[model samples]
Target: MQTKSFAALAIVALGQFIAGASANSGYAGSCTNIQIYPPDGNTNYWKIAADCKNNAGQTNLNTKINIDSCFSNSNGALVAQLNGSFHSSCTNIILTGTVLSASCRNTGGANVNTSIDTNNVIGNADGALYCFNQGNL
Candidate 1:
């Protein structure tokens, strides 16, 4: 009986360790107050508005960042222009039947390996966007 309990405890500890190692590790920042406005430039383009901030993890020191993106349902992610000193990593923005999924990023250089459910953005309630400095790391 003692052996069985020890084995079970060891198994639980190993599981926790594996889960922690495989967890989603991000940079020292996050994107908040994300609001998508309808069509800023063309009628088929949706504008991006959010409050983002990140430490110098993957990109430069971004106290506050503004990420402007032209995302639409018909045209997908058209353009991502940011008003900061970082690279726009918003690629493959696909609007799969109202479920928009893109590698939305605003970083100088960073690498992140997380699952699809890790959330890119926050405050949207329904879904999450992985935006570290409007991006992720």
Candidate 2:
């Protein structure tokens, strides 16, 4: 009887150990940071910068920049979206958006294609950048 009891306790302890190991197996989610630069210089263009980190166990990580609108004049419009993907940690990511024309009537635009200027690192997860217009028309 004592041997049987000892065996049962050992099994329970083993089960608990396995459960704890699985709980702390891998990185659970992702982290993303974004910075926006206003329209400037001769080109009158805006830019969005992003940084992302993907913990282990994550997959199909995607990063994006979403432009709401650019309203100044007839030539004003916004780039719809800019995006990038990663499988791990990264830094100093540069994503360029469309140029804002110096026209009043050409205002408002949506997600535009993005160019990945620099991808310092790679990991697994999803991330994005959102640009919303909050200026008066």
* Leading candidate by lDDT: 1
lDDT of 2 at 40: 48
lDDT of each model, Cα atoms only?
A: 0.34, 0.31
The C-alpha RMSD in Å for every predicted model, in order, reads 14.1, 19.7
lDDT of 1: 0.34
Write candidate 1's Cα lDDT for 86-116 as tens digits: 1134444433322335544424343322112
Expressed as tens digits, the lDDT of each residue in 32-94 for candidate 2 is 343455444642344434454434433323343222231112123212222211211122223
TM-score to native of every candidate shown: 0.24, 0.23
Off by over 4 Å in 1: 1-29, 41-44, 56-137
Scored by TM-score, the top model is 1
